[model samples]
Target chain A: MSDRIFGGIGLVIAIFFAWQATLIQTSFISDAVGPKTFPILLAVLLGISSVYFLLKPDPEPDWPRAGRFAEIAFAALVLLAYGQLLPEIGFVIATALTAGYLAWRLGSKPLEAVIVGVGTSLGIFVIFKLLLGLSLAEGPLGF
Target chain B: MELLASLGDGFAIAISWQNLLYALLGCLLGTIMGALPGLGPSNGVAILIPLAFTLGLDATGALILLTSVYYGAMYGGRISSILLNIPGDEPAMMTCLDGYPMARKGQAGEALALSGIASFVGAFLSTCGLVLLAPQLVKVALLFGPAEYFALFALAFATLGGISAKNQAKSLFAAALGIMLAMIGVDTQTGVPRFTFGEVHLYDGIDFLVAIVGLFALSEVFIFLEHRGTEKDATTGPRMEIGRITPTWPMIQSCIPTMGRTSILGFISGVLPGAGASLGSFVSYSMEKKLVDRDGTFGTGDPRGVAAPETGNNAAAGGALVPMLALGVPGSGTTAVLLAVLLALNITPGPLLFQQNPDVVWGLIAALFIGNFMLLALNIPMVGLFTRVLMVPPRILMPIVAMISFVGIYGISGSSFDLMVMLIFGVAGWALRKLEVPLVPIILGTLLGNEMEVNFRRAVTIADGDYSVLISSPLTIVLWAIAIIGFIIPIFVSSTLRRKMKKDERDLTD
Candidate 1:
């Protein structure tokens, strides 16, 4: 994205935050400034900064193209799915699947990726849960 | 004498088999992390905090391990900078200016040895400074009131903001964003939910570990993915045939004065609240270049060039701890992560830390002493082994790093919600990186935001809502002056320097 568009987004966010800051409800009858003070001040500062960026946009950065964006988005999806499945499927299964997929995406062969993924997942679980005695989410099969 | 006596007790704690083992493990891991490009001390410490907690180590033992990793990484970063020309971390960037040249010339062994010894000298002397000066500094810290604290934090924000990013306004914006994030949960004084948006988890503040893991580790994974197939083989150059790992007697004697000068310089820089190892090493390298290498041989395999930055950075790491231990203010990103760990362990690090938790404080100091020694011992014979870490393909490494981050955050909060938070911040952090906004200020803003607010409120309360109370104290006035000057002087100096260079070019052309 161009610096102009980025700065525009920042300005919108800053203004929205400033409006939200005005909405914060304060119940304290203290002599000092309320909890709203800091946020409001921060919003004003951010708004000013956004104006500066809007006025003097930076040189165009080397952003990734579509192919790389797909890679990143896929990786992010894998992580998000991993988090969602963690409690349901357990640590070992969820970790192995996600890590294996990621490894494959990084150019590892299927078998090698699976072996590494499963091995790492199980190894970490054993170390953290068994040896260290920290509890990890268990699968229905129970370890 | 009292400091000596306390240090003796600290040694007793640190010398125990358990603490010693922890220190060794930290050093080993720190070296590996530091040797790897893109996994510096902050990431190393952040990724390990959950593991430290899961192991159920007490605060003191955890700190010893974590801090060992901190300085050990500083020592290990030189390995890659010398062998591969790619700095493993920011401080090591200066090392690459001279170190890679030395390696290409087949003086890799000598360069490695010089850097190792310099790192030891820097870390050791700064640790001595920590022991002697921390107590006195702590006494002075006790005199600070809310107004003074506000000014001090402002100074921290100003100096830190000015030093980090090229665009100071962008740095300040990032800091403001961090403070906004910090204010998300319920307000402590008013019991008002500020920005929680009615989420149940929002009652408690955002977890620092979660934010950090997302910001440093996961975003790093995204960045790694972007350049996965494009990595040049770091080991492709000349086969590094290091003869003797140790510097000869004459070589050691030659570096003594340079090491001493840079160590002191680095230590002072480290003690400042916003000046970190990168600045320390840069200043030391440039000063040495001007003083000794007048003929411009500093970057062309000069041994003193390697020695200066290596010593300066490691010394600065040790020096950075002084402010964190004495005043509860972190000087750099790594130390800010350390401060988070201390808070997670329910230990507040400030003036009272010395009086209340002497064992933790003293034990950490003693551990630094041992950790530095262990790093030197480990770096010499093991230097070759560490260089091999550069060979780990980003494909495999990025996934492992991501997995570690996932498990680490999961282990801490045990909430999928928090994991989601990490993922969101990871994307945000990556976007911010693309925008050229530095990440350090965000973390600093989050860490100090609450303290700044509390102190601001307290000062106002004391003066019956008079805003002038903030500038009433002499100490606060001085701090405010320093803060303003710190922000403006850098801009003025840089602009003047640019103008002078332009004039010189015009004169030459004429």
Candidate 2:
């Protein structure tokens, strides 16, 4: 079941966390419970919980079909790409592309997606950046 | 009289033009944010927080704005439930049971108006509860030591299961994950870097704001992408006309007692650690149904049915503020967001908060009172606007949601690395949610992790690494008992509640 896989992954994470906790350097002046104590305790707690989850797995999760999975994966990728591209292409351009792509995939007609994307990017830029004085990533055009 | 005198000064500050304007703007924005079916209040507040920060408001102005968004979102949540059979927030789910039915029976307007009134009653009564209770809690919190604080934080994690998550293990796991996330920054007490992984940005640890915007906001985009292929995928109901807008004097008269009693019950639930508005609404609805549903009219569009949960959840929303102000441990996820705001503003909420920042605290309470009235006015005349928001295509809406997340987080943190971390949390949050893990515990863990660790460290150091110090005191013992009972009791009770919450009422609106 997916629960076992989740638990196995959790177990792996716990082990890695324990190793990292062990590696943390403590100053000589620090008290009895150093920085590593809490993290190590957490790792042990996670280890026990993961073992329990593995032993008593829940029912199989209702997973999507492969094509549906691809769509979900792509959506996540778009979010990732939006964060990645924000600095490169500037906020407005990056946000426009990201929002336009997401809107288009979310069921807007292509033209409507473009319009929605442009409007959203501009609206936020003017309101959030220009008016409110919140900083955004600047492109070559200075907006 | 101490409360009275402080409240007088509070009114003076809260009545300022700048503070009132922030409150009004926050109310307008929160209603729209919450009405956009699926964004809910947590994300609504989270998305708009950057704006609050950027607006250059003082802490008092921000507090007024904060109360507005809080009450405004509470009001807006019921709109989608009544019109679209979709809960605009977790607490609003209860409203859908009778609200959609009322809407179908050509009473949508009345339902909106009545729930608005019930919301006012709940908010008003609970703010009174907050005024009376927070000072008392501050007195009690002063008795807490590091050991007792450790026990209290553990109790919080145990009790925060709420209604949605049936698996306690998953909630615990999420909590652990959040603590580890919190450990990413350099250790505060020691100069040692804990888990920065050689990344310079990791030195600051995971910003709870970035994590919040990502977890609550961006994951919503993913969930929307998953469920929404077309307009008709989730919602199945007729676009009924919102008949008369007013609940007649008779209807309001009948539900008056229900709203009054549920507000009290809901306030108590909200005051309980880990018991948030979800439980508040659920318990109130069930209690009222048992008390008054003699003809089984609780769910079949009964006015009391709509009033009970509305009052309960809104009251619970106000109740959740009590602990956050007095103890600094947020009783609900939204309060957790507000807690972050307080911390970012350099206001440490605890027993000292009363003595240190009377203006901020009193002003906040006074503004909450004013904001409740503002919400009532907005919810009634603006029901049409909210329902129309429900009809907005996900095509346009989801992107705006996504855009807001990006822009908001970017603006608030002003760091691309934080944005990337946010996206990562977003993906992981989506994965964790699919696995049925509760996100609130994760948030609570992140918010409280450093404090929890420091308390434990302080306790241990004082006792010279004596582990028994963790449960040495009566207060710690009591907190531990509640924590243990809270984590275990849900296993037996959730099944019954889950069965009661079956998906049978799918077509309440036909």
The alpha-carbon lDDT assigned to residue B497 of candidate 2 equals 70
Off by over 4 Å in 2: B163-165, B230-232, B235-237, B503-510
Best by lDDT: 2
Q: What is the DockQ of each candidate?
A: 0.70, 0.76
| CAPRI class of candidate 2 | medium
> Lowest lDDT 10-mer window, candidate 1 chain A?
A28-37
TM per candidate: 0.95, 0.97
TM-score of chain A of each: 0.91, 0.94
DockQ of 2: 0.76
Clashing pairs in 1: none
